[model samples]
Structures are given as structure tokens and as C-alpha cells.
Target: MDAKTFKVEDTKNGTDHMLPMSDVLHALFLQRHNDTGEEQYVFRREGKKGHLVDVRDSVKKVRDKSDLSFTVHDLRRSFITCAEGLDISPYTLKKLLNHKATGDVTSGYLVITAERLRAAMQQITDAILQHAEIEKTTLIQRDNL
Candidate 1:
């Protein structure tokens, strides 16, 4: 993974993609990197794959503890809903979700940059944080990036 982007090797479409990290995510990743040292995978395990392949058990544990029932796809849906509610451009949202334009001529002509995606990501993050009542002052400011 790069400092600003996280690479997804096993995507649903079997194609790799790089996702720009939001400010909060970037900070969290940096902290994790510092604690774990340089490793091939961010979330490692002593398994055959040498990394976490399935998180169902972990999710179940969290659900058991917190009584919050949600699948990983729910989080993705929430993100899309949030981005739509914010009126984020469709192309940007598609890029963030790593979805192909799929015969959209205009989308084919568009080239969304990492910087633009980062800004959009930060906006989405800020919106989510705000909805969660997290204090803005406590977060890493977007200008700092």
C-alpha cells in the first residue's frame, strides 16, 4: 500500500485497484504501520494465506459484543448512500467504489485523479464523522494533507 492509497489485490471483479485513503484512514494506517513494522500485509494472520482472508468470525464477535447486526456489504451501502446524499459526482463515486463505467461514454472520457478522489474521500469521511457526532477539531484536518 502506498502512503495515500490502499491497494486491493483480490477485488470482486478479479481486478486489482488502488483506493485513496481518507485523512482518518491514512492516520490509522500510519499508526498501524508503526506498530506492526513493515509487513507485506496490513492485517496479517498465522494462517495459510499469511493474512486475514475471511472476517466473518471477527464480524460475528463484534456483533455479539455490540449487538449491532450488519454485514460488510451494509457498510458499503452506507458509504454509497452517504456519497449520494452529499451529491458527490457519479464518476467520483464510481471510482471510489472501483466500479467500471460499463459502456458509459462520458465516464470513459473522464479521468478522476487521486487528489480529487482524496478530497472527495475526506468530504465523505467528515460527513460520516459529523453524523456520528465526532468532534471535527479532534480529527486530522483536511488542509494538513
Candidate 2:
């Protein structure tokens, strides 16, 4: 990667708890390494490791949502499960996602068409959904972090 210009990472949603990519990848890679000894990437928690936050103190709490069931993290799990299908450039994913860092001044310097980026993201989304045995989710609805 060239250089990072963003201030705080993963605060795009104003979300109180944004899980780090490292934790997700570490657990995922561990799942792979358990079978094959070859190492992929080592994952470690990023800044402010486990700063205290409570589930009840969420930005938006879903009462009907299952406690042991689908919390917001499940959406993230679904994302990683999908992104892993191919080596997605994190930069591209970041740009495609309106994750505050969207205006990174690198590739973000260029004004990309929603259609083009949307297509690329859609392809990834389809591949990811397919990999997870999930049918595709439609694009008519606005998508974000």
C-alpha cells in the first residue's frame, strides 16, 4: 500500500464497535492453518484493542434480533467470508465502501462511476454470497458499511 491518510479506521458508520480486520482474518486463517501448516497472514487487533463497550450500548439495538443469533457482526462475517473468495484489494473495497476513508486522495482522487464500482462490488458480493451458500442480495437498496 502507498500510505494511509485516514485518521481513525473503521469508524465509518459512527458505529461504537467496529471489529478489526485482523481478528476476523486471524480466526479465518487459523481455520485454514488447522488443516494445512502453511501460514497465510498473521492477524492482530488494531488500535485501542478491546476498548470497553457494551452490547446494550450499541448505536442501534435490534431488540427482535437474536442474542445468540444475528448480531451486526454476522454481517461482517458474511462480508469476510465473501471477500476471501478472491484477493480483493483492500483499497478498492475501502473505496467502494463509503468507509470515511473513501476520499483517500489516491484512487479516491478519481471520480469513479457508481455503475462501475457497483458492478465490481456486485461481482464480489455475488461471489461471496455464492461461497457462503447464500443467494445474491439485490442492489436496488442503498448499500453501505
Candidate 3:
């Protein structure tokens, strides 16, 4: 929430991550924050501290509404594939996804910058929008600006 960035203080992997929110995600987060920022999790069950463990029902509802048959993991794979299509460096994409680089020697020296990750994320977002036939909106923050 610092300026245009969002901080993930803790994760299941026991690591904290910070990401600059793309405009579309920022708007979605803003709406969620306004609706339920008081809760511990953005999409938590009512009266629960933990997030909704099983979003299958909700995902099904969305899938039914959109008439798109896909599991939640499909969305993750689509994001990764689109980002890869842009020729985003594997290291950058891995960093964006919070994956540990174990065997790569150069990854030990390369520091992935927020700017680079933001650019990669934007590319992925743009690709998704294009694929979905959604018009690009000014809601997404651009680094060029």
C-alpha cells in the first residue's frame, strides 16, 4: 500500500514479497480493500481469519458465468505461458512467481529489480487482455509514464 506497491508480508513459503500492482489488479485490490480490508484475508470466509481454502465453488460460478471451462491452476499456467511468450527472462519470471532458483549459478548474482518485474507483469497482463479481447484501459499504471 506504499504509493502503488503492495506488500505481501507473509506467504506459505515463509518469505515476504513485494509487487507493484498493475493498473487492473490495482483497481481490483482497491475495490476489495474498500469492501473487506478489515478482514485478515482479502477473500476469506465469513468470520474466518484464514482465506477461503476451497474456492472451487466460487471458481465454478465464475466459470459458469464466463462460459469458460478451466480450473484455477489453468489461470496460473496461462499467465506463465503468456509471460514466456513475451520472451521475459526465466529468472525474472521465476522471481515474479517467487520460485527458488536452485541450480542456476548466474541467478545467485542477478538481482531482479522491481522495475523489471513490473514490466514483465505488465506484458503478461497486456497479453491476457488481448487474448480475452478486452480493451486496454488507462487504469493500469505504465512505467513509461
RMSD (CA, Å), each prediction: 4.3, 16.9, 5.1
Candidate closest to the true structure, highest TM-score: 1
Error of 1 at 43 (Å): 1.1
Candidate 2 has a TM-score of 0.37
Ranking by TM-score: 1, 3, 2
Clashes of each: 0, 1, 1
Query: lDDT of candidate 3 vs native?
Result: 0.76
The true-versus-predicted C-alpha distance at residue 35 of model 1, in Å, is: 2.2
Assess every candidate by TM-score.
0.85, 0.37, 0.77
Which residue pairs in model 3 clash with each other? 23-140
| Residues 4-109, model 1: lDDT tens digits | 8988778898888988898788876776666566666776664444666778887898899889999999999999999999999999999999898898999988
Which tens-of-lDDT digit does each residue in 112-139 have in candidate 2? Answer: 5445444555566557545656432232
Model 3, 7-103: lDDT tens digits are 6656557898887777677676766666785775667765667776677888988999889899867987888889888999999988887788898
lDDT winner, 1 or 2:
1
Displacement of the residue 125 alpha carbon in candidate 3, Å: 0.8
Query: What is the Cα-based lDDT of residue 28 in candidate 3?
Result: 64
Candidate 1 positional error at 137, Å: 6.8
